[model samples]
Target: MSNLAIPKNKRVIGQRELVALTAFMMSLQALAIDAMLPALDEMARELGVAEGNQRQLVVAVFLLSSGVGALLPGSFADRFGRRSVAMFCITSYALLSLVIALIHDFTLLLVIRALQGVLSAGLMVLPATIIRDRYEGDQMARLLSLVGAVFIVVPVLAPSLGQAVLTFAGWRWIFVVLAAMAGMAGFWAWKRLPETLDPLDRQMIELPVVMRNMTHALLNRSAIGYVLGTSLLIGAVFGYVNSSQQLIGEHFGMGTWFPIVFGGTAAMMVLSNLVNSRIVERFGARRVSHTGVLAFIAVSALQVLAAFRHDGDIVYFLPLMATNLALLGFLGANFGSIAMQPFAHIAGAASSIQSFFRTFGAAVVGLFIGQSYDGTARPFAIALLICSVLALLLVLYSEKGRLFRRLNAPAKPETKPGGVY
Candidate 1:
């Protein structure tokens, strides 16, 4: 059914190209964050950050600002077009990376990172909005999962890349590499990415119109519940990323192998997302994600138990943590697709608003979890369990207490006649 619904002759790019491009564009966010993980300690020392937990601000501040910045690009995209806004954001991101590479002051670096995050957030928001311009419902979930499978490659390799840079060229050059990558991505987008916003569906950029559209998207019962739920899940993941270097490298005595260990855990998500893309259409996004959430809670419970043992045994901790993180592959794309179901007409504004909540919520929760790190995994474990359980409740609320039932009335695209859906 989803296969038959493909928007034929509408895309300037092929399906495979679209998926790969969107995934690479999305991967930029991951690369920006993850590539800095291995270098955080070095960055801390150079920037005069004496406290250990403060280093997390480098990542956390960017995430927080990205969330806040997510609100603008969508409305602009809705007014102008996705391609123009995306191009502007990508170029700004590269330029900011260049600036950060030259900065010496810790506060100055963080300020630029925050600003960069705001500008670059469109890189995260626009891809999903573009996908929504082309597809929705379970088919959208499948495509997003495919995107996730590819995006996970960055997390798998970014830490190692950071480590290699740190080994040879020092931490500041990490930003130089980021600038180069962003330039490449921006160039690809310029050459190949199409304007996905149909003229008929475009909204005015006036404050009132933007607010109304944003309010409508947020007020939708099904959408907000899933939005909040997914936020918590991703928040927990960000928390892990925040403290992962210290946890794996310093506390576990795996200093040199941190990238390999971190990347190995991230690799699990690649497999899970691949499986999700394959099965999501058959089982439905709700059932697959619901099952995944339940399994997540179970694994999270064991993680809490493992952390409580105070054994500090990497052998037991690594696999359990990896499994728990992998479950996000099942939840993220499905939850996002479901939340965007009723907003086909205002995909840009809706995507931006939802992205704001998701990213902002995750950033706050993750910052707390990251700062709560006590040279042990207990804080992380407890936070994951709490997030998973709350997520289940939110999912239940979204479905009116139902768990595994599929959504029968899938949303129809509101595109005009002869326009891309």
Candidate 2:
């Protein structure tokens, strides 16, 4: 059923063009993180990193910084317009990647990575606002799934691409490619993408206004629940991303084939999104995604048992991990759509808050799981199970105990306590 609530008069952008641009913009986050996976160990050694787990700080710190930086994008996007904000972010991202290439010190490199992540917030957080600006309900969910399917190709290709680059150049050259890609994306946005936020809807970027918006998001029951649930799942994905090289390459002895195996597994997420796009319109985002979350929990729990029985043998471990990761496609796009639904009028702020909390949650939980790595997949398996269950509970709370049922309509978020703004 079409969402009757979607305004009939919204400006139309070509679906193909919109999807491609938004997906490309969103893929920056995936590319920045995934492309470096194969090179982490080599980079770690060259940079004098002793602990393998600490290498994850490169990933975790970036995510953490991006989440924090997300606090800035929404209001600014509301004030200055989405296109301008995105351009600044893409340009900064390109320049920082160059700076990272020049930095020889590991600590300084990490600090630069963190800063790059902050700039990355515009790309990561604003896509949802752009989409919400144009669509609502299942239409919104379906579009997001399609864009995610496209965005996911980055993670799918990045490992192998990184390896290929590693063959020809050192890891530092990876930053060169990142810089070049961002430059291209910035150019694309500047030339082709039109501003989606209407001038009438723009808000002044003010401290009091931001605080009120933030408070409304936190107090809104459904939005906050979905945000919390999504955060747990993000944490699980981050934990896996942070440790996949160690588990597959170092632990399973895949060494040279690490990229292939990792790429193949990440491809499952792409497949999941494709499947989601096909079914969500008919089944409803809630039913399809709720079922997906349940399946994720069950699969994660089974993986824990498999780790116990198989003792982290790659044959049993890798497939289980891949299967669990695939389920993420279902939960992520839907959870994000649901969480942002109540804030359609303030999409930028809503997107920023959701991304900030989710990324923050992912970083903290991922660091804990990564630091627990002990030459095995057990810690990772257990972490997935725990995160999945917590996410399920949060979903239940968000849905008011309903699972697999289609929601009647989107709930309007409760306004801030004050009559202000």
Q: Tell me each candidate's TM-score.
A: 0.86, 0.86
Tens-place lDDT digits, model 1, residues 170-274: 898999999898888888888888777666677766787888888888778778889999989989998998899898898788999987898789888898998
Question: What lDDT score belongs to each candidate, Candidate 1 first?
Answer: 0.86, 0.82
**Best candidate, TM-score-wise?**
1
Predicted structure with the largest lDDT when compared to the true one: 1
Per-candidate total of colliding backbone pairs: 1, 0
Provide the RMSD of all predictions against the true structure, rounded to 1 decimal.
3.9, 3.6
* lDDT by residue (tens digit), candidate 2, 151-269: 98887777777899999999999989999999888888877777777665566667878777777776577778888888888888778877888988998899999878987888888
